[model samples]
Target: MSQPDTLGYLVPQFPGQTHIFFWREIAALEAMGVTPVLFSTRRPPAGLIAHDWSEAAMARTTYLGEVSLRRAARVLPRLPWGALLREAGRDGIAVLKDVLVCAAAGEALRDHCARQGISHVHVHSCGRAALIAAFARHLGGPGYSLTLHGPLSDYGPGQRYKWRHARFATVITRKLIAEMQAELPKDLPPMILRPMGVDTDYLRRDTPYRPVQPGEALRVFACGRLNVVKGHQDLIEAVRQLRAAGHDVTLEIAGQDDDGGGGFRLVLEQLIKQHRLQDHVRLLGAIDAASVKARLLEAHVFALASWHEPLGVAYMEAIACGVPTIGTAAGGVPELIDDGVEGLLVPPKAPEALAAALLRIAEDPALAQRLSTTGRARIERDYSARLGAEVIVSEMRKALG
Candidate 1:
């Protein structure tokens, strides 16, 4: 089958601070001669929209959270009551409530897709947005696909119902695929292993990466949301250990807390104060892609000690920019970085181990050069945004056929 002229791209809380990969994927789809109609459950919080493209993205997106009562009433009779009841029986009351809400949004989505001539949608979330797409399918709106970005548990209830109706699903890691196979039904939709990727072309460094000299401060860059599960506190402890060991090091973390920098940022600040890392560690507070790339280029090493990351695009961006990265050996990180080859991997929440890894990279220029060269090469070869886009389009073609 030939490619459709338009495709629907659905994301929950679209254009959030950590949604750069979705933006890159949309651009990739456009480059392949496919127009992506952006759909979101709702707009993200104003402060959490940090990217320069947030305004333009918001201007173009169609939000489905605002359900018209007239439309809901019109489509109410069309809902598959039998199937919904079965879903409730399998999942319970809470999921049924969410499904009902998404059913309303599905009615609106059907109307919008009819007006825009969108035949297929790819949901980038397995959360409520996936439920919206599923109900849209039930309403005869569009054939929908799903991308499982993390563990199914993190996406919330009704896992079986969400996967039952998808044309196909793309999981970020083989580990996640295994978990899905174990938890979900055997008669499930086709599952593809397509890890999230960064735009290597855009994330590449123009200038040469400079290693930390003997006297200069070892600039370390970490990027992720300021949450406890993200292990920012552990990274801070590592920075303190590196300083205590008499290595000149400075760390800059480029992300904000969920509460628009008020919630977990205060907690991280208190920890930094306890360690007396006020001068050595700075929270950059949710920087833009250009700023992150700039910092990656300037830093000697990049590190993020996530407690359990699905797959880290920040690590990809850093590696794509030729900065030797250090990620904890948790979740799908080992799939991205080899232990001692492309980048370093330390145990999660082990501040001493993280400190040792950082010190090794700072002390050894040869190891840093090898990791920098090989890490960028790895991204260019297997983890480019273009490659992921191609796989998605290919899968969409097969499904539509």
Candidate 2:
């Protein structure tokens, strides 16, 4: 088959703080001679748009949430109301309202694709973005696919309705495939295991890996959203434990809370002050990708204690940068990092175990060196953003066929 000339890329909020992987994949696809028309449910909050590419990305994106009375009047008359009502009836009242709102966006999506000559769309979300695409197809728009980044429960309701009309779906982990199969119907579309990836070429370490020498201050780095489920507080406690044990440790967490910088960051700050770790811990709010890479290179260890991560691109970035990474063995993380091979793993919410893992890497230079070497190798081997883009392109072709 000939290569697709144009493809529609849908994300909930395009170019958010943690969406560097999507940007990387879009670049890879562009390099493969495919033009990706960007689509999003809405623009993210001003603070969440932290990437350097945000301006260019926003300029090219079509936001469905920018609904105007004129556009709605023009599109609503052509919607597949009967089909949408029938589907929503099977779910409940909540889904009925959701489908109604998304169906309008769907009509707008259809018109956008028609104008751009795009025949297929790939949604990087399983939430309402999936619904918008599905509704667009019902209105005789483009065929669509979905990429499930986390558990289905986290995305919201109406799972069956969302997956019913998709051409195919890509999941980030094998465990999620099993969960999807068990929850969704058997008559669903083809499911592919395509993990999220990073740009290894850019994330590569420029200098040699330097293990922390004896009695040197241990610099630990973590990157993730400031959420309770992310377990940033637990990581802070681990730093406190390391300090109490006469080990000099400094932790720099690079991320902002969902509500700009005011929400969970305050809680974490209180914890830091309560423990009197005012000087030891620093919260770096929502650094850019280059800044994150620079921090990873400067740090002796990279760690994020997510209670349940589907698969972590932050961990991938750190490992690719040759930082000895530590992650909780909660979700798809174990698939990315072997317990004792590429990096270290500990149970979630266990500050003591987290402290032990940090100490082990801090005390043993050999273990840190081994993890750093093998971890970078692991990312280079199976988790480059280019590889992920190839899988997506192949799947899109298959779906088009």
Candidate 3:
């Protein structure tokens, strides 16, 4: 029987504001009378235990060592056949490194569980946590499972690799589940029926703010990492077009670039200068979650032009805050927003369509109000954190059944 009192929740790190999914879900599981033991590379918060693996920074952000290790694993299969064997032989050494990582991680977790009288382990992402969980289980640790989010878990061979590990899988959308299921055998365990959730408590704010005026500055807000797939470029251009047409629209982009990533930030900067949008745009990097929420609370409308949104929590939060959304119809967006309801969906990479939706929302107050009321209620009914946690615990129950 699975242990009900203590659940070890694993994350590669514990500091990302975007991935509060992992941390907040832990909070959810904890409220279910299950102790959540969070395993991370960074030192845990007070009264919470953490294990450190290695310190590597991307964009000055310290992440776990497993990230680089996973990248090296990807490179190993591409070497010359002779070199491949050499690496394969050294794979034992690599395994030894993993052994150390898992030993530290598992001991921290297992010891915490033993003292607290805990039983099961659950990892938030399938990448490093999958390996750690498998290793921990091999070490005779707690029965474990993993929850998968982000493209790293779904894109390319990593998904296939991670598939070999998780006991019971959880994804945020139907598309992600289908993609994973199609890639694997039929007899694999059923994917959990849980999606990303919104903490209605934060979004349940009764604060009302006035929107941007058409004759005045039409302030547009966009948030997310400045990456290609996020479609921030398209958003900037759309804002430029509106401004060029005598609409004084100012675009405020609040996020960090992927830091040595695709140099998408340079591309965006060039686009902004070429369009002469010096006054029309503001780029704010990496604000705290409460600030993001505050921004949402004060904004006229919220928009995310991502080309790969598989159930973005941002939309749920914006909708819950009564900020109508204009999102790309890519990925799980269509599943979340109903046209003329909670929000509107536009085709990805299409500035004109996004601009049209923006214009509609900006012009019609009655439509926006109806959407806010209905959307907020939808959050309360369907996407509450408590509801999401209950769903997770139920998934565990079914697996144990």
Q: Model 3, which residues run further than 4 Å from truth?
A: 1-3, 41-117, 150-165, 208-214, 260-263, 397-401
Local distance difference test values of all predictions, in order? 0.88, 0.89, 0.64
Give me the displacement of residue 341 in model 1, in angstroms: 1.1
True-vs-predicted CA distance for residue 7, candidate 2, Å: 0.5
Order of all candidates by TM-score, from best down to worst?
1, 2, 3
Put down candidate 2 lDDT per residue, 1-401, tens digits, no spaces.
Answer: 23266899999988799999999999999998888899999998998888889999999999997776576566666766675566567666667667656767888898899888889999999899998998788788899999999999888766776788888888899999999888775647899888998998899988888989887999999999999999999999999998998999999999999899989999999999999999999999988888998899999999999999999999999999999999999999999999889999999999999999999998889999999999999899989898877877888887777
lDDT ranking, best first: 2, 1, 3
Q: Please write out the lDDT profile of model 3 over residues 148-242, one tens digit for every residue.
A: 66554342222333355456777777777777666566424557757778778866667654555557665567778778888888888788777
TM-score for every candidate vs. truth?
0.97, 0.96, 0.79
Score candidate 1 by lDDT: 0.88
Each candidate's clash count = 0, 0, 0
- Write model 1 residue lDDT over 104-200, tens digit each, in one string: 8997787788888888888998989988888888888888899998888798777777788888988889999999888885647999998999898
The 10-residue segment of model 1 with minimum total lDDT is 1-10
Q: Name the top TM-score candidate.
A: 1
